[model samples]
Target: VKPTTPRGQLPLLKIDGKQYTQSLAMQRYAAKKAGFYPTDDIDALVCDECCDTLEEFLLKFPFAAKDEEEKKAKRAEFVKGPMTEISKFIEQKIQDAGGKGFVASGPSVADIMLMVNVKSVESGFMDYINTDFYTNYPGITAVTTAMKEHPKVKAYYDSLN
Candidate 1:
């Protein structure tokens, strides 16, 4: 699978016999096609900003720590510092966008990205990180709740159970 991908990565998109790499690029394309990408310039910028910030936060995970204790300490430090900071930034962004449960006028790729991030952190898959870490950030919670409540999204999640 790795060899078949353009960048030897998992996220490879094939369309019309053309292969595409880069998860974000593929996400943006899919979002646009699905009408989940904002059409307005400013809204698009906000969506991009939110997605980029979320990706940045994900990239900060210390996956290369030399030992379990070191990894735990690094993760703990990250949760206490950068993670909190990024969460606050996302919370503020959501609030600044009128607290509409989205960073733009309607559902966008940013909302989806935010939902994914929230779910990931709360999934208990990461050691030394509390699943309730996002509870304090109402804005983040609101967006995730809103996304989950969407009829289509709700149905999809329900099907998984």
Candidate 2:
């Protein structure tokens, strides 16, 4: 199944018989279709900036190592360095946007990306990172909290249970 995708990735979106790869691109397309993308140019730029920054952060994760211990060490280093810096950058972006837990005036794809990143970190799926790591960043955590409480988001999670 993976080999059949354009990029051999899990998130392959097929629209009207056209195959599309790249998770972020698919997310943006979905956002636009669902009205979660900003119409205003500046707001849309902010959303793109936030999403790109989040993507960069994810890419910095230490996924390749010669051994388990080395992997853990590298992950710890990432958590202490790049992870902290990126989180701070995002926190400031949220603050600049009126501390609303969103890069734009309202919830956009950027906010959704932010929420997902926060959940991933806080889920303890990444070793050596405390589940409460995001707790220190109120602005970042606020986005996750708001997203989780959103009616549609809440209902979707409820249905999963």
Candidate 2, run of 10 with poorest lDDT: 98-107
| Model 1, CA-based lDDT | 0.86
TM-score of each: 0.89, 0.89
lDDT top scorer: 1
The per-residue C-alpha lDDT of model 2 at residue 95 equals 90
> What local lDDT does model 1 show for residue 116?
83
Per-residue lDDT of candidate 1, residues 42-87 (tens digit): 8999999989999999898766689999989999999998899999
What stretches of model 1 exceed 4 Å from their correct place? 1-10, 159-161
- The deviation in Å at residue 36 for candidate 2 is 1.5
Off by over 4 Å in 2: 2-10
RMSD of 1: 1.8
Can you write out model 2's per-residue Cα lDDT over 1-161, one digit (the tens) per residue?
A: 99998777788888899999887888889999977789888889988988999999889998788998998899989988999998999999899997775555688888878888878878877766788998888888888899888876678789999
